[model samples]
Target: MTDPNQSVLSKLPNNVIDEILIRLPFRDAVCTSILSKEWRKHWCRLPQLTLDSDFWKSKKDLTGDKRATSNFTMTIHNIITRHSGPLTKFTLCIQYWEIYPPIDNLLYFLSRNRIQHLVLKLPRQFKLPPSFFTCLHLRHLFLQNCLLLPPPDFKGFDRLIRLELHEVTISSKLLESLISNCLLLEQLVLRISDTLSDIIEINAPMLKSCDFTGDMTTICLKCVPRLTELSLRYYRKDWKEFDVANFLTSNFFESCPDHLEHLHLDYGVIAKGQEIPKKLPFDLLCVKHLCMCIYLDRDEILCPLSLIRSFPFLQYLEIQMEHNFKKNMPALECLEMEAFPDVIFEHLREVTLIEANASIREMQLIKLLLAMSPALVKMVISPHRFLGKSTIVKTLTKLAEFECAPKAEIFLKLV
Candidate 1:
């Protein structure tokens, strides 16, 4: 008879056991070594390791001593040194300690082991070493709060598919060279950076999605034929400093390829007396989804209407209303319904209004869209959170009474 003490995991094949160990978290995987002789040292050979600082913080809390910090640093050094096989993925978020030697060694080891995906959230003012850029096998890279200066002999990571930089300091020319060299890059995200003051021109041919949020003098999209989705949210406080009118009308959209489908624009916290152009530079005849967040005065309610006319094939629309006291003051202006263009939304189907207030101008805008979109199927209205039930009821009644497409369905969602 077989010994009943034999564990079920021990009976499994070595390859199958390795697969199970790899799925466990780094801490738990290492702890599994105490279970039996067969499981010992198995975690050391795993291909992926995530060295997050939060893990060490919890250990420090348990030990109730400051020495845990040094031990944490040593623990990471030992893991990198003892590991035998290639490390395909590594995520290091250094939040507690400022030690650089061990971290540099870790990066060197990962570079030699052919790491594929690396995420580094380093401390403030920390500069990434040149060896970090030499990881040719990297497919996804995310760096936050660090300085990025490529080496003189830098050839880009050709295999990189997705790259994200948040609060990183790098020159415009260096950034352009980096993107130009990534032949396989498909997605890129750039958050606010203090050092970025010059124009940003993206010429990635294979790029599919791009998200940019910052204050730049100008943004140029060139040679990006495959780009479909683009989101731009400019820094709010410095909106007046930027040339909003020139940026909107300066062939920015005309340079983009025609296949663009989704667009999101948020002009945050516009002050009073700022003029927003009623006309957009490029016609978005192919766009199917559009989202706009603006702070427009009563007179400028026609701005969104003008945008609607540009997209004849828009199927879904989402609008976010920003409250501006100066803009919200009651005012009356005769809306010339006939003067507006008689464009038909042939493929338009759905519209969603968030934080919608039942203003007269808003109602008129809704009525115009409803009259134009014969193919509309549904409209969802979500009131602001602070609105009372009675106000919501009134808003819903107003929408229901409004004349729309014969078959269009209306939905009122209260928050």
Candidate 2:
């Protein structure tokens, strides 16, 4: 039999249970209400309500009214009205279809509620409301593929700590003004398309990390005194330059003057016809752990050995490509249909290559590795294939024999 005292404590006050459940993912938390009458009632009073419907597939012939939008809106409203305190997080992610509820009404409801974190994720064409910028209590905001109305001047909250913009295009100047106004901002991730014009200026003093994925858009970051981590993932042929001399430059790198430890850069360039091969820049001094990935298409070429040698303190290096390796051509040769820089890899502790098809070019790369990087402790080469475990093991052994580097511990990923 259940202890009466224990049962009484287990069935805590409704507000306490609701607050606890509010922290959970929306669906899981809502399901808890099904356990008993008490829980069912309390779930409706949860402060944080989240909806991620990417898994919900729409029927080909269903109309908007016949879908789940009406119930979803009703349930959300019921939960919000039942809650007495502010919401900690509110997320709504809808993918795979073109169905949506009223955007204006949703924004108005959220604006009135004291929400600290808000996430909006929709597939390509969903339009967002301008009133979203008026949220004064929001500290974390994430938008994916939702068109944001350009703020007239940057009058959002000073309490914002993290802002992630994905698949949306806004003027760099307006974005810069917004960044400048977020004094307490920390992480800024930009996954944008090409409506970007002019340079983005970021002036958050307490910013600690920054991650950007897109074409090289001009950016200016200022007053980042304690900044440390940075990740740049480039998928196109746009130039992203960092002027070390400018104060805004410090926002991304913080100059690492007091020992900035981690630095990661994954970039790819697709060269166009008649376009001049550009020298890739790797100009930094104090990075302890560095990961640089460069992808060169048939028309794009890699930088010179002199340029690769510029990084004096790199402890790790990873170079990946999608080509036949037997040709023994330089990775950069494909980009420019030309030769590669002189080989130089001395200080690297760990080196890795990914998805190279041709075995001959793989052998040449290993030969260069043996001659250049005497200090390399580990080397891994992996092919791009999906097969059984036995087949993968056999392939690994074959590739290892083809470009064997005895000096370093080699791991061949044949699968």
Which structure among the candidates has the greatest TM-score?
A: 1
What's the distance in Å from true for residue 37, model 1?
3.0
lDDT of 2: 0.61
Candidates' TM-scores? Answer: 0.85, 0.74
Q: Which number leads on lDDT?
A: 1
Candidate 2 residues 126-156, lDDT tens each? Answer: 7776767667788999988776564566486
Q: Which stretches of candidate 2 lie over 4 Å from their true place?
A: 1-25, 45-47, 54-68, 95-100, 108-113, 123-125, 150-154, 221-225, 235-267, 272-283, 296-301, 304-307, 324-346, 356-358, 387-407, 413-415
lDDT of each: 0.74, 0.61
Off by over 4 Å in 1: 1-6, 12-24, 59-69, 95-102, 236-241, 269-271, 296-299, 324-344, 357-368, 385-390, 413-415
Tens-place lDDT per residue, model 1, 1-415, is: 6445547766778778778877776777788888777778778888778766545557553343456556656777779767887789888776434543246667778889989999987766668887787688899999887788877888888899999987777888778878888889899998864646567789898999988887634467977899999888777343555555556666777876788899887645444455666667657776889998744354555555666677778999888877643444553342445756666788889988888776656666677678778899998888777767887788778887778887899888866
